[model samples]
Target: MGKWNAKGLELAQKLEGVTDEKAIKKLATETMQEIIDACPGEGSIKRPRAALRKAIESVYPSLNAEDNYPQGYYRTSEGKGKGERYEHLALWYLTTNIDRWSVEGDEGRQQYWGNLPTLEKTEPKPQQTKQQKPKQKETVMSQLNLDLDTETQQALDFALKQSGLEEKEFISRAIAYYAKSIANRHEVDFATIPTEKLLNDSSLAKLPGRAEELTRRAVRAISIYNDDIAPENSERWAITQSAIARLTGGRAKSIQKALEDYQGMIADHHAKYELNNYSNRKSGGRTIEDTINIAEL
Candidate 1:
């Protein structure tokens, strides 16, 4: 209703699932408190009792009763609509926005559940039958704004027409081609996180999957940063970092450094490796997994 509450909702988007009711509530309370701290004029100091939960519920409204009351968690809910919707929302959101934090209960093997479309958790995956169905690839949607000169646009349109493919498909192929053939020569501009420290020396299981997940997030952020800027001036990326940042509302210094480093990588690549077309002609945009893997590369 007020500034603090509105900010509270924005903060709630950052919440991943915690283990139990107590943890969730504590997280919710902390989130609300953060909003209150940030929005001094919102007068959230007098925010109602359980106001934090109410604010949090605004984000995950299905949260109802805790599976374990008092000492336990606010993690589980019993009601049909609220709880079910929460599960669906969480699964869809986490899988698509893999960069987002995940729930406590949904870690470990449960993380694999993200691969499925439905919220329904299957029983422990039965022993692999000899006759295994091909896994279906999940889908993700991204939107972009791009600009091109009339001639380039005409060329793009002509190519798409000749290929009989939609804009997204053509774009996907072009991006894949450029990355593999053109962009793979040099070191990336950003550093990736190391999860080796997370690995247990004694446990054969080694490190938890979260390490890989964190790496994926870092990779995604860099990929997104590169993709989101100056589509029209792509050819001049080496010399146009300032323009790119101005257009994209990003820091010019950062853009300059990334573009220069990437260009250096390309220049260096020319010395050692021949360009690789890596041809595997497909009809359209790849599966979501393929897209993510390409970005990682």
Candidate 2:
């Protein structure tokens, strides 16, 4: 059996007679929290959750299918508030399977439960030879030559003077900010439209006339931007502005206006559809639902 399966069996034996659902959930939550606290890094909870779930599944095979479990047994919602109900179910199964797990051997039990073995206990490093020379220290910093345009050079000089920071420090901060901005750029290539379409469409330069079309494109970009980008990053708004500018061939001011319009439109759309069931009723001889499909957007 796999490590988690064996661990699950062992856990089952230990949790024998613990039939209370609340008790089982508390034990599982505490176990996971302990693992997360011990590791103290990214994926600490995620890795242990996955392992524990696998172990639980080994004991209760019915959990693998939605039909075998109650409604909302896996997730509680469709959006950000969705809860992991399966984790609790998995823990309950482990407690109930004590008889089945008791048959497994005690081998490998020390590796997972109780105190995790230290690195030194698991594997020892090789000793250095007497004749071997110690390695030389490596350089930690790298030097780069930059060819800045007149405008950029002046900006950098002004920033350095205003901030009272060293030239290297100012440049380093600028580079870091620029790198993060570039990273926040739209993950999807202009909402899956070909680059050539936006770049080659010279007619997009004519603004105000094609403002509606521009707003539609901005809506799509905003939808994708919100889904992919984190709200905490201030650069996210700038990145979305840049995307709209590229898509519509418009200036910063024009793109900003388009974004404002897109936001208002989205709010109006949601209010109409949700409050009035506007999609089901007719308006101006046609159903508003037929006219506007937010899902398509």
Candidate 3:
């Protein structure tokens, strides 16, 4: 591929779109689904790994691609021949290099810059003239350090009390949402999506009772997300309700958020999981029902 020009950065920024703070926050969410949709499957013409390699090469064509995967690449064949060798290599490469973006600081959450490991800094040169002042040493700090002034803290506390959402709740949910947004952007496996079932159904439902329940719920949730049925409609609602219950272990507040997030994902994935139902026609899409029996589970 040719060099990744300003055009690529421009396209990525365009993909981000123009917006104010609130609008940007919402767009931050939609970007996650876009990343997920780009996930590779049986006939991946452009695997995420390959696409990333191309992007990196475009920027630094002289860089050795093999050096990027020193452990050698995995074959995409099935059974004993298939493994996660290359996938893991690609993950480490990206984690150590690209795949970074910044988020704007919110009320309780702050964003940080990410990059590959850096070499030690060299000492500053001595001033040539005595009149020149010595360079001040820099102090690095973690973002978690509280930067709020007393008045700002007081106002925030009062607002939380008035809103009936304790500071803990606000902070916890904000962190969860922000973290999920990042995961979505990076196309990291949503621990929420079950992959074990897709590989092998076997007697997954016959494991030890507790294990069986966990496996069953995961299989069902994966089914719902990958299915072609209308995920936002009534039929899918049952699955969403069950998924929330499973994820939150029956906590009311947890259930509320889980349900909201699950529905949000369904809406975000509408193009894949069509919302329309046509009983007479057979669909190439997977059925959300067969994968998950929420009421029975």
Question: What total of clashing residue pairs does each candidate reach?
Answer: 10, 0, 1
Residues 71-177, model 2: lDDT tens digits: 21232222285433332243432321122121222232222233332212222223452112122101112234456688986775555446544345545676886
lDDT of 2 at 200: 48
Q: Candidate 1 lDDT, tens digit per residue, 95-123?
A: 11122222344353255445443323223
Clashing pairs in 3: 230-275
TM-score of every candidate: 0.20, 0.23, 0.22
Worst 10 residues of 3 by lDDT: 133-142
| Model 1, total clashes | 10
Error of 2 at 190 (Å): 40
lDDT of 1 at 195: 30
Write down the RMSD of candidate 3 (Cα, Å).
Answer: 20.1
Go through the candidates in order and give each one's C-alpha lDDT. Answer: 0.37, 0.41, 0.36
Flag clash pairs in model 2: none
For all the candidates, what are their Cα RMSDs to the real structure?
A: 24.5, 20.6, 20.1
Q: Give me the runs in candidate 3 sitting further than 4 Å from their true place.
A: 1-17, 40-104, 111-297
What value of lDDT does candidate 1 attain over all alpha carbons?
0.37
User: Which model scores highest in TM-score?
Assistant: 2
Worst 10 residues of 2 by lDDT: 133-142
Q: Write the per-residue lDDT of candidate 3 for residues 107-163, one digit (tens) a residue.
A: 121122222222223344344521232121011112245577899867755554454
Better of 2 and 3 by TM-score: 2
